[model samples]
Target chain A: MTGVETLIAERSASATAVIPDIAHYLLNAGGKRIRPLITVAAARLCGYEGQGHLALAAAVEFIHTATLLHDDVVDDSALRRGKAPANQVWGNAQSVLVGDFLFARAFMLMVDAGSMRALHVLSRAAAVIAEGEVRQLAAARQIATTRDQYMDIIAAKTAALFAAAAQVSPILAGASPRVEAGLEIYGRELGLAFQLVDDALDYGGVAEALGKNTGDDFREGKITLPVALAMEAGGEAERSFWARTMGEGVQGPEDFDEAVARLKRHGALDATLEQARAHAARAVEALDAAPDNVWSQSLAALAEFVVERAY
Target chain B: MTGVETLIAERSASATAVIPDIAHYLLNAGGKRIRPLITVAAARLCGYEGQGHLALAAAVEFIHTATLLHDDVVDDSALRRGKAPANQVWGNAQSVLVGDFLFARAFMLMVDAGSMRALHVLSRAAAVIAEGEVRQLAAARQIATTRDQYMDIIAAKTAALFAAAAQVSPILAGASPRVEAGLEIYGRELGLAFQLVDDALDYGGVAEALGKNTGDDFREGKITLPVALAMEAGGEAERSFWARTMGEGVQGPEDFDEAVARLKRHGALDATLEQARAHAARAVEALDAAPDNVWSQSLAALAEFVVERAY
Candidate 1:
């Protein structure tokens, strides 16, 4: 992980001042290394000690960081990871260009990872992530967004990268295709569970704990699973309430409390957590093919922690 | 070029509706395909006849297209290629995401080219292009920008990709190292020539003819060589005029005309053209190491056409 950090810091450096400035700002913002952690664990569990894993880890982080920067801009977000986003700090134009710089830099780092197969996986995942984002945008505020649709969105936007990252270390290690497939399932399922918990926390958790204000998804007219489920389970009154706040984009100050109250009344947050738990269990189950090593054990614990964060 | 277009259309397709929708719109907009032309010319001139060159050509165009999409958003322009830009039609958020999709798709195509060396060249160029864009933003509207600084910006943002695209086909062809380096120089210098002509035409060309409104750089306070030269040559009143319009970010409708008059009076446009001509000649000269085939001759003529656009 330190090697990954070192590679990130070194690779993100550029003669262009704002390229480094914005990259440093976003990269140093204390982001969770969940993706890199998965890559490292997979490497260790698969008995790969080559330095390519570190570079792959760094490339994965770069992909994550670049997407974060662009997502902030696309969402017009003001803060990320509890501090001012790079877009807000540097302005949108520089943010966009710097995001591009980081993205292009990620491909270069992947090349350095020295596996064309891993490169293909990561690059394809990147394209899928972009597709997922576009689909999510098209579905935003459309209240009729289905659970299946929402799942597809998350699978593409968030879980695909996780799957790709997990697949990389094993591919680099020349591990069996079965092992690679198992780790990939582990990653994708864990990512789905993690995102479900995140979406649930947005409706149920405190702002300080979450490092961002609650009701942002609500405010942005973003339809996550909980909102979709609640909307589905509710009657006319609930539909109109959601329609006014999210569909019409006309939220008053007190509207968030009402939204939350409705979520609680319908037990949507609990159901969402339920969905998350099932996914986490599947993530653990996917690891049955791997050896019963401490790394795999740590991975199972991490899956549990992801769902626990909802509490 | 048709093969390149076919590949772009095929690769940009996604299960998500808007991914294909926006991509189709941008890729179908009758772009000049000059980058593909350059790639094909290089490949043919160097005695290469592989499908990898076609994939590389498509990848090169994808990189160019992706940058153009991002550039339109970063500039917030309303028009591209004589039509409403993708950002305006689909909105900025979708434009940004689709741009990412195209960029990632470019890498996939490059990987399909089956040459890691070419992949490295294009990826590094993409990063440099982003860095150049950021550097341009940092140097934007600073009336005191040096000529050398202006050169650096264009070289990175415009010429680097051209150079990369030029190098790819030759690399796939397994041309001699000296020939590879020579083609790279040809590409970079031709790109420099192309961008210089673009800048000059932005000041001197008509809006309808250029497919974009002139005076955009003046309005955006983008410091190009002509603007730099005009700023340096101006008197006290001229300085204040430029300072007010570009430096202070204030522009009136009449200011564009007055700015053009100043450009003519200072011979800034002509001097810029001279600089472009020098680059074009250098571009042609760089191809001397290659076979004296029609393709190389066509490249030389294309360089002339690039500079001729300014007139």
Candidate 2:
């Protein structure tokens, strides 16, 4: 993690002032650095003692940061990591360009890591993440989105990168195919649990705890897992409420409260949290391939931490 | 060029409809394949007889198309290549995301092209291009951008890709370092010439000839080369006019006409055109490292063609 921090500081330095200015703003915005932590943990679990994993961890964090920058612009987000987003501070144009610069920097770091196979995996993940974003955009106001469709969207958007991040370390370590595949599954399930908790938290958690406004998805007319499940379980009145709120993008002052109440009434948030725990359980199970070292144990506990915060 | 087109069509296809839709809209919008042409011509000049250059050419064009997509969004452009811009058709969010998707796809293609050095060149070029766009954003509407500063902007924004595109094919060919360096200079100088002519044409060329509205730079408050040169050569009245129109972005209906008139009186367009011719001459001279075969001669002729349209 120290090497990752050093690599990030060194690489984010650029000749153009605004490039580094906006980059450091986002990088210093109290981000948890969860993805890079996974990269390092997975690498150490595989006995990767060399410094190459540090570059890979930095690259993973770069990709995540770049996506956050672009996501803020695309979502027109007001706050990120509990602060005004880079787009708000620097303007959308600067944010977009800096995001692009960071993305290219990520690839450059991956190339420096000198593993062509890892490059292939991460690059493919980058493309798929964008595809998932586009898909999410298309599905934003569609309240009738199925559970499988929702899973597919999250799988492409979030889990793909986590899988790549965890898998790339094993590739760098020359670990066996089984270990690499198991870590990838560990990463994917952890990401799924993480996102499930996030979506559930959007309905049930406090705003201060979430670092973003609760009911943000509802305000944006996004049909997340809880909303989708609520829609499926509700009656005709519930359908119209959802149709007016999420589908038609019409919301009153009390609508977010009503939406949450209905989610509670239908046990939708509980259902979502239950699903997250199931995925977290699977994430822990996937760690069976790695030896029970301290790093592997920490990774297993991290999966529990990802979902437990929502409770 | 056929191979390039096929590669683009194939790579731009994605499961998400909007990604491919916007990608095809931009890629099929009558763009002249100038960058990829340079890729093929440079490969041929190095006497390379492999199919790998096709992938490299496709990667070069993907990078160009991705840049155009993002540039339109940053500029809030109405038209591109004589059609409504993709952002106008698909919204800025979609354009930005698709631009990212294409950028990732470009790197993937470079990885597939299988030269780490070329990947390095293209990735570095991508970062430089973004830096240039950011600098250009900072320079916009300032009314005091220096000629050298403007050169640096265009060199990064436009010429960096050309240089990489020309250099990569030789890397694939395993050509001598001298030939590779020569083509890089040729591409860089040719790109500078092309952009200079483009700026001059905004004030002098016809609407239909340039595929978009004339005086777009003036309306957008961009400090292009012609405007920078004109400001340097102008008096007090010209200064105030530019300050109001370009610096303050308070343009009246006739201000574009007046700006053109001032450009003519100051010989700015002619001066810009003269600069283009100088770069074109350098581009031709850079070809001395390669044998004077048909491919090399074609590249020299192409450089001349880049500047001739403005005259």
Off by over 4 Å in 2: none
- How would you encode candidate 2's per-residue C-alpha lDDT over A1-311 as one tens digit per residue? 88899999999989999899999998977778899999999999999888888888898999899989989888866468778888888888898899999898998998898888888899999999999999998898898898999999999989999899999999999999999989999999999999999899888757786677787789888788998888889978889999999999999999999999999999999999999999999989999987789999999999989988997
Which residue pairs clash in candidate 2? Answer: none
lDDT per residue as tens, model 1, B1-311: 77877887788888888888888787888777888889989999999988888888888888888888889888866468778888888888888898899899899988888888898899999999998888888887788889999999999999998899889888999999988998999999999999999899888866787777777788888989988888788877778888899999988878889999999999999999999999999999999878899999999999989998777
lDDT string for model 1 (A42-156, tens) is 9898989889888888889988888888898788654588887778888877877888888888888888887889989999999999999998898888998899999999999
For residue B271, give model 1's deviation from the true position in Å: 0.8
Q: Poorest 10 consecutive residues of model 1 chain A by lDDT?
A: A205-214
- State the weakest 10-residue window (summed lDDT) of model 1 chain B: B73-82
* lDDT of candidate 2 over B1-311, digit per residue (tens): 78878899999899898898899998988888999999999998898888888888998898889889889878976568889988888887898889989998988888888888888899899999999999999999988889999999999999999999999988999988898899999999999999999889888857787687787888889999888877787777778988999999998888889899889988999999999999999999999988899999999999989988886
- Stretch of 10 with least lDDT, candidate 2 chain A: A204-213
Each candidate's DockQ score against the native complex? 0.84, 0.82
Cα RMSD to the true fold for all candidates = 1.3, 1.2
